[model samples]
Target: MTKTNAGRFFEDYAPGQVIHHAVPRTIKMGERALYHALYPARHALYSSDQFAQACGLPFSPLDDMIAFHVVFGKTVPDVSLNAVANLGYAEGRWLVPVWPGDTLRSVSEVIGVKENSNGKTGVVWVRTRGLNQHNEEVLSYVRWVMVRKRDASSAAPETVIPELAKVVDPSDLVLPKGLHFDNYDFTLAGEAHRWDDYDVGEKIDHVDGVTVEEAEHMMATRLWQNTAKVHFDATVRPDGSRLIYGGHVISLARTLSFNGLANAQMVVALNGGAHVNPCTSGMTVRAWSEVLDKAETSVPSVGALRLRLVATTGAPFALRGEDGKYLPEVLLDLDYWALIPR
Candidate 1:
């Protein structure tokens, strides 16, 4: 009898199956310090307790991505241990701010699955939710991954693709309790631009780039407890190169956006995202953003801006080609809503 656990394969999943992922993590300032070191994240609201208090938060909470990564990491063992690729995401929303000392865990429900014609692999869609120790739901999203079958001859499961929302309605976005940006300080935040300053369809080149490093990426993957074999084991890929985690690119692009969008503080919702291309170490990642739309929130001075953040290895602003396919140089395309001072 084998004592070691082998993660779920495509055939092992069924619609409506719920998986309780293991290993709850207690977040602390150490994680925050390491996160800042790994990525160039310097949002004022997350940087200073005074700054966050000024904006009506109790104190500086953990970076939103920290909570996201922690929750995502917890799901790896059960959800994507045998994954070939993490396909995409949709209808994600952050319900509560994660404060230090909070313990977080994750649970996922198998919402959909489809057998690929190739027979060797299939796609599994799961809706995952992150909850704190109090069992309060903090973050939720739907993600699909391509996973290999334990046996090529295994029978395929009935295809069931979930009908996911194309976008999270603005009215459904959750605002952090007491999070009013009425007394926002542009000088301290590093950018004077407000919600009114940005127009729809406006694009901004962040004008910065960071070369992905093998050591840094490994440390980051370990920090988040992401154990996907392709991210750490070079042997997993045919070329013997460890693939960069998609979340790493997402965080890097979000950090890079601070150059011109410093005031766009908290990410309230993730409408959709795609990892258009795989990234590897030694490539320089650059980021750019386009304001998709803007809307007023119920908060006194807080507004929401729908933005598309793009990560690329090539020139800035080049996205899909004439044929409606992602350009070879594009790495990630993410659509989300962020809170900004009005």
Candidate 2:
């Protein structure tokens, strides 16, 4: 009997299967410190306990992306160990604030699967949920990955692509209890722009960039306990380059976004996202955002802004080429809702 995990292949997945991922992670301030060190995340609500209290949270919660990475990392071994590429995301939401001492684990249900034309790989769609120690659902999202087939001769699975929501409705957004941005301080938050200041279709160039290095990327991946072979073992890829975790690009882009959107405090929902291109070490990452739409939330003091966040190494704002495919330089395109002062 094999003592180690060989991981699941494309043919191993079937619709309606439930997988309880291994390992539960206890998020601590140490992880917070390391996260801050890894990215230029300086959002006020996540930075100061006093600030978070003023905004109605008892204390500063871990960064939203931190919770995301930790949860997504837990699913790597079972969901994406043999993945050739992470396809896309949809219908994601953060239901509850993750405290520093919270222990988080993940569970996933295989919602859809389809074999590729080449028979060398197939797409697997799984809806994953992150639960705290008390079994409360904290975060949830649907992601699809292209996993390699162990044997090309294996029979292809029946195609069952899930019809996911194109966007998370504004009314359905989950806000942390007592989270009111009425008392939000513009000074401490770093930017004076409020919800009313932004107009739909308006674009903002964050005007900052970070050069990512392999050392730091690997360290951050290890911090989340992600065991994806492609991220660690360079020999797995024919190009001999380690693929930077897509979540790293997300956090870095969100960090850089602070310069222009400091008051966009909490991420309530993830409408959709795509890793357009593979990012490697040595790329200088920059970010830009376009205000897609704005809506009033149930909380009188808080408003929601639908924003399109783009991470690219080339020019800003040029997402796709004439053919409608994402440009070669684009790394990530994310659409989400963030809470800002009304």
Candidate 3:
């Protein structure tokens, strides 16, 4: 049996280094089916091949987050093997739409490396680029992580911290080329929301719930090749329990919002995301969304809407601020940008 190359150590990276992550992944219809069932995603472009062609796509494409997971998973082996924490992401942009059969690969370049003042851990920033079979850059983002040094006795390296954006500018979000909904099918799109229909303060409670299972999450984690012991292998944790991947819940909530937010496609800006509580197998996950802000994209054909997508465990319906902050059922809070049809 072959051994797994999960992640790298701090000593293995250097500034200006470029790592081409391997294991190209081909998105399939089965993945699409899992996506739909996982989050109740109803976007015509990702729902039916027939409906997708009507929207000018060659075929149904995988969900955007799925593309992100595949690309990010590959970098784990070369970048975050001994990571203490994932600091943040910025300047993210999706350049191309991912089709069902497209093979995806990733390459990351070390943008900066700095030794922390404490001398025990350091920060590493890398720009990961996702590409398709034709070598087209599908998506790119700058992410940083805190890594621990194996030998604290060694002297610190150069202190060259890179300036990072606190929040990705809404104006910089890239719209997928040729993505216009001039003739967008509202019926198949599964929503009547038009570009002008949303208000800056509009709140939408996407009513849907999914009961997560150990087998389901394990399959997803293995599919992404994210072998973080806490996410799998229950024996590694003191509690003997597997921790669900935060990204899995994020994708779940984002997809569930599709019922009434189908036109709200293309995640442009990821403001911030948090997994409030630990999620385990057999937990029923529910979701709701709130329109925090809205902006016009340079893409004359679409509008950018910033939203807060929330995921809750053990709930069967949407969220309502009954006892003050997100109800006790809340499990996640994610802020992101989506491009909607104009």
**Model 1 lDDT per residue over 1-342, tens place:** 899988888889999999999999999999999999999999999999999999888999999999989999999989998999999999999999999999999999999999999999999999999999999999999999999999999888889999999889999999999999888999999989999999999999999999999999999999989999999899999999999999999999999999999999999999999998999999999999999999889985999999999999989899999999999999999999999999
lDDT of 2 by residue, 1-342 (tens): 879998999989999999999989999999999999999999999999999999998999999998899999999999999999998999999999899999999999999999999989999999999999999999999999999999999899889999999999999999999999888899999988989999999999999999999999999899998888999999999999999999999999999999899999899899999999999999999999999999999999999999999999988899988999999999999999999998
Worst 10 residues of 1 by lDDT: 293-302
C-alpha lDDT values of all predictions: 0.95, 0.95, 0.76
List the candidates' TM-scores in order. 0.99, 0.99, 0.82
Q: Write the per-residue lDDT of candidate 3 for residues 16-79, one digit (tens) a residue.
A: 8899997899987777777565556666666676766765566666778878888888887678
Candidate 2 ranges with C-alpha deviation above 4 Å: none
**Comparison by TM-score, 2 against 3, better one:** 2
lDDT score, candidate 3: 0.76
List of clashing residue pairs for candidate 2: none
Candidate 2: residue 52 lDDT (0-100): 96
Give every collision pair in model 1: none
